[model samples]
Target: MSSPLPLVFDAPKRGLPPRHLADLTLAERTEAVAALGEKPFRAKQLSRHYFARLNVDPAQMTDIPAAARERLATELMPQLLTEVRSVECDDGATRKTLWRAHDGTLLESVLMRYPDRATLCISSQAGCGMACPFCATGQGGLQRNLSTAEIVDQVRSAAAVMRDGVLPGPDGKPAPGRLSNVVFMGMGEPLANYKRVVAAVRRITDPTPSGLGISQRSVTVSTVGLAPAIRKLADEGLQVRLAVSLHTPDDELRDTLVPVNNRWSIDEVLQAAKYYIDRTSRRVSIEYALIRDVNDQPWRADLLAKRLREHLGYLVHVNVIPLNPTPGSKWDASPKDVEREFVRRVNEGGVTCTVRDTRGQEIAAACGQLAAEN
Candidate 1:
């Protein structure tokens, strides 16, 4: 294995702007309200407006007394994300929003509409520390981990977008729907921002007015093979799906492709994944980005299947993603023939594998591309 990387470079820059309602648990919010000289129940009211009603405007909160409403809103509903710009493609069904944080940090989140459901891809950190060469976000390096509120508000905003019928439907007309799936596959390695990401997940899956009320099963958290973090997440008692970005089956290529691989080998990562499956009884997702003539060989596919079968057996699935080449990147998606053959080999080796339906390519949908371009 490569020598362990120095720890100084990867430690997240701590802290966020003033606390917001989404940043606190119910008990914390109650204490915050009391500290501001308001009754404890006012916290519940604020949570209902921000979470269930998805309204942050004090004026819209008619249930609260007018005087206290403004103070409460001003104190706990601080705007965390400002829209820098939004770009859309797939006939406006896919929208990517670039947001500027209070500290001038830039991050991107994508809301994609499909026939059966709407999925929002959220960022856990401002930029990625994983340093995956093919990813645009990793190119910029990690700026800072997002606050829990910063992460939760993305889902809330996207939920309102879906609820209010902003995106067009199958008939190419606006139709209201519920945002169903939330994927932590944008801009950052979620496990690198572990504490806030876990808190955000709770705020997302908890029942409203405590949270956005999205089901735990609908949430997916992806990491670039953070082995210890994977097992740590399993112990949290959450059923959210775990996705490992195992770009290659072999460590030689993976260490270059996913720099984090040097810290935790494939065996260690798979062993951690098996622990997650054993804990949650949910199938762990093995994410593989198929770069042309690189990590796309039939032998690699067979080896990936064999390793997965050996470690995880029926508790894992492979998601073969076509490489979304970043600007001026040497990496590109494999030819259809090569991708198809790769999938066939993995399936033949006894693990289920499927090519992901990639979207928003025309609009630079790959993770940090939009934020980087803007």
Candidate 2:
């Protein structure tokens, strides 16, 4: 049978902005600045203001000559995202922002603050082309891949919000904290936009004056079992966590749920994941969304555990996500009892499993829900 999945990476580029500082390396930035008739050191100043201090306003960059600030900002710091609206929930600990790109494309990024760490879930593309029937984003199909700067800007914006005490804490007070974690679980299959996503990761984990300086361990890049891409990422020599959205263990069920499974079988994906673990020495995360009466059968869970144990052997953890049913969709989350049993069976087979904490349901925080509604 012909594959149902849409090839997303080659999608047409529309409204992608001109080159910005975030898209360039330090040397490249220096060259870009000099092209504007400024000294090489000006690039470092701009990087400090944007990446290190999270400030982008040209008016506040007093260190640079006033005449050059506007020119540099206009060229290097072009505004990429404009907030359309922001909604908060979970006692003000979770905030989701709807951003309008230059081309009027709508994308979303969620900032969720927990007791121990704050995590930002950012989108890698405007819409997804994986065609996973259950996913709101996937259902809409791919719009275009986000540029490297656009991806990095989301993290920088969230980190600024955390540092500036913009979002309220669980105690209902403006509690400033660090943005410690980032997950590429928002809209597109991250690995589909492989080059930009990899560039974004480097811009996120590199230390001050170069990038965001967040530890690689704190960043998680999720994919829907793109086996070759998984192996390619393993060789990047970074410690960032890898999450596979393997909703089912059996090729039969997975082929229907995750359309990409038709191309890369479950065993092939798992073997690639094993290669990742062997190379990175970091535990892989298996994300399984439990749909009612679908892939949530206890026996499937047992098979999931068995397959994982045979391949990963304690080097993996299963994050069982209760289905966030789309509006008017037939799919529904598995019952609590069924969910519990699924977890139980996975553990019984010698693999760790837990139900993930579902957040921002009220604000359409699950993937492309907000953009779809808008």
Candidate 3:
């Protein structure tokens, strides 16, 4: 009899490599190295190279004996991703890279450098299952959950680029800065790949020599209101910020814009957001994409602020994103007057709000637009 076909919802599982250095804890890394017939202490050296130095080239590993470097490189430091193409903007301050995984699974990540900070936006999944109509990543559907290493590798590469003065800015010089922040806001809904996303966060926030050691406060994980996952992350002892993508105020329009609303209504999602704030004391960010004639209205903004005050009180900030129209999509940003009025009404109801800065539109840097082009 033929084997049953894999479920349509099953995540892509073929391209990932055998468990490597990234999937381990400090102790586990030592154990893994010992298991490979090397001294356990060598694990620290490798970790220092990978995490502290962001160096993956085993040939330059002088600390490890010349004889053993080849074996370790062959066994431990196998290439996880190869850069396919890189699109840059803002005089190279913003860069988006398309990567082909070991088995040819395609994924993308963006790195941006500014005067104050360098931020790397990486994908947690190859594609997303959340069918938010306006989002390119969601419309592509779920391909597979990216491995924890795959997620971490994106940050490592961006950090390396920043360190090496690769990205040029205006006035034709490399911006002297290091990666200061990371956001899992590319190509997929991070929470949908729950376990791996959390693991990636651990690897990101843990102190260097164990991981990249970025501050927990600098990491932001965004979701389109995955209720249970929101509650679970609150209990994870992580200080990372939580961003809820609530495209509309009421259940009526949100149900159509964010289909996940069909399962969990506006009230249920807000309650969960409240739970996060009560438990963590970290401000939750509400993401509202302003689409013309759809959910952008003065009264809807009033209702959004009213409900947020009634539920979450002062523990939330609403980030209004002016819709960046895809090629032929009817949805577009609201006029300046409409947007200002909406913000005024929201502030009148006592909730803080601001418009998000648009970056990389010239190169289709808004979420899944790049993936769609490829």
Q: Which candidate is the best by lDDT?
A: 2
Question: Which 10 consecutive positions of candidate 1 have the poorest summed lDDT?
Answer: 6-15
Candidate 1 deviant stretches above 4 angstroms: 6-15
For model 2, the superposed segments whose C-alpha errors exceed 4 Å read 1-9
Per-residue error for 35 in candidate 1, Å, reads 0.9
> Across residues 157-260, which tens digit of lDDT does each residue of candidate 1 receive?
99999999999987889999999999999988899889999999999999998899999999999999889999999999998999999989998998889888
Give the TM-score comparing model 2 with the true structure, all chains together.
0.98
Q: lDDT tens digits, residues 274-333, model 2?
A: 999999999999999999999999889999999999998898999999889899889999
RMSD of 2: 1.2
lDDT of each: 0.92, 0.93, 0.86
TM agreement with the true structure for every prediction: 0.98, 0.98, 0.95
Cα RMSD to the true fold for all candidates: 1.2, 1.2, 3.9
Shift in Å, residue 317, candidate 1 = 0.8
Which parts of model 3 are misplaced by more than 4 Å? 1-15, 169-172
The digit string of per-residue lDDT tens for model 3 on 44-74 reads: 9988998899999987899999877777767
| lDDT for predicted candidate 1 compared with the true structure | 0.92
